[model samples]
Target: MAPNDTQVSFALAEPPVETAPAPAEQLRTRFGTLTIKPAHKLEMPRGPFGFSDYTQFALADVPNQPASQFRILQSLEDTEVSFIVLPTAADNEWIGTADFEAACASYCFDPTTSGLLLIATMRRDTNGQVKATVNLKAPIVLDTANQLARQVVFTSDAYTIRHPLEL
Candidate 1:
């Protein structure tokens, strides 16, 4: 019967509602408009050669590519910065008969989950012909799951930086 022991609960004020962050959108580069789904965006921890400024890139599929495994890596920062990349696993003849998995392990990479080993190719020369070489010594490993990527360099002489791209 004594109301002195218990305190009555009361609410006269409301808390502010929090807003959710906006969804990520595809970055448009000079190459062309890109539309990389949220899950397909590849995040490069260390940008490519001389490209220390930009890290974000989208894997864009090119029509009538030299090979079915070839794709375009469009830089979101600079429109002029784009690389023609190909997965080594897609065609062994392109990279050679080296131990691809061993090369990944040498760089502390996991072949099973690291997505794919992509070799970067020069866009083209003044001759208007595709560069007849690809970087076999170093490959860009795309971590599709975490959207992360890194360029791993191999010291072995087995692979060359400019292997003739007969394609």
Candidate 2:
């Protein structure tokens, strides 16, 4: 499925529930203290690469950037374990529909129900200019229906681990 077909909508203002509400947990992250509800938490059977021990994570929107495509994938196990991610649809130049579908299929992810998020990194170049790059080779496939996520690596040469963003 194409990225557009898998777009997930996040309702910022949750509607009132009739039943007892789930207790919200607060965690201190690099972004500051974030209140995470049970619905916003994700379980990773196999955590992200290099961080296998940490399986629980909370998906939070970037504070003060409601319209931005960026999101915070904060690990519940550690305060310092957080990453900025962008939806695959945000940048379709490198990862085509075919490549994305293939990668998701290998991981048994339903392209129709699963969404992709690319890990983003920033650094200063020799010119003293900040450059941002996204890891397209390995993206986190989120099964929104089940709130389960896992990192899948693509073997396609068309994508790179660090694809420079033209920001």
Candidate 3:
């Protein structure tokens, strides 16, 4: 009876790194087959500002956009109905002096938690040039956790409908 002398030492295997979750589901629409990550889908509690017919929308990043500050919110029901939206915080200067924290507080949303403030995009003719504007009167506050959006309007008239771009 001889004892084995060649026992090799073994190390515990390391866990694999976490990877992005699989696509929640696929949506076939005007944007083509979009493998929707759950986060991209959104619902409007009362629908966008004046748009009441549609309740469901998906946020999409524009392909090859220069500024990359705009997102296309495509209506689930209508292909032709879509909105170009901008996050107010995208540009620090564009974010007016209005009380955004108060607005969020009124809606029971805390931007520090799971919330994003956005505005509807508007096109304006500026001295023979077409420029983009954002409606600051009513801002769409998105709840990242519930995916619910509410277009909250401030009581005071500090924000206007046409906050045109400085450029």
Candidate 4:
């Protein structure tokens, strides 16, 4: 999914006496408390590759790192279930290729408007240094217009599940 660059504003208005107070919109996560808005919520029909049980998620910006390339795909079903993702630009070399377009098309996604996010995994090396890698083979494709998403797997060998990050 793409990084949320737009700021959402809520109007300050008192509720009518006849209506009850709205349910809390705040979601407490490992990252912190996030204001759960409809705009930021995503519905995964098939969920991720292995986590089909939990289909609902929220695309949240990394707390205290607005300029960072990473985003959090927080599972609404389970507060502890979350994944770090990297949004791929439309002009990205691999994403702009015909193969990538075909992959997206097979899943009924429009390459031009669909947003792609690579799942990131981090590990510690022998030297006690941390390294990060992204799964290029399997990416979460987001239908931004409908707030729907699905994890698509590319059959081509060009992509790797553990594409190392520069860090």
User: Number of the top candidate by lDDT?
Assistant: 2
* Tens digit of per-residue lDDT, candidate 4, span 105-154: 77787766666778998899999898998898888877665677888887
What does the lDDT read for residue 39 in candidate 3?
Answer: 61
Give me the displacement of residue 53 in model 4, in angstroms.
Answer: 1.1
What are the per-residue Cα lDDT tens digits for candidate 1 across 47-119?
8767878798767656434234456777777778888765444124434434556655655655555534455
Q: Which 10-residue span in candidate 3 carries the lowest summed lDDT?
A: 1-10
lDDT (C-alpha, whole model) for all candidates: 0.58, 0.75, 0.58, 0.74
User: Highest TM-score, which number?
Assistant: 2
Which residue segments of model 4 deviate by more than 4 Å?
1-24
TM-score of 2: 0.79
lDDT of 4 at 101: 72
RMSD of 3: 16.4
Off by over 4 Å in 2: 1-18, 126-128
Q: Tell me how far candidate 4 lies from the true structure as C-alpha RMSD in angstroms.
A: 6.5
TM-score of each model, paired residue for residue: 0.63, 0.79, 0.67, 0.79
Show model 1 residue runs off by greater than 4 Å: 1-28, 63-68, 90-109, 115-117, 120-131
Q: Relative to the unseen true structure, what is the C-alpha lDDT of residue 82 in candidate 3, on a scale of 0 to 100?
A: 73
| Residue 91 lDDT (model 2) | 36
Rank the candidate models, highest lDDT first: 2, 4, 3, 1
Superposed Cα deviation of residue 66, candidate 2 (Å): 3.1
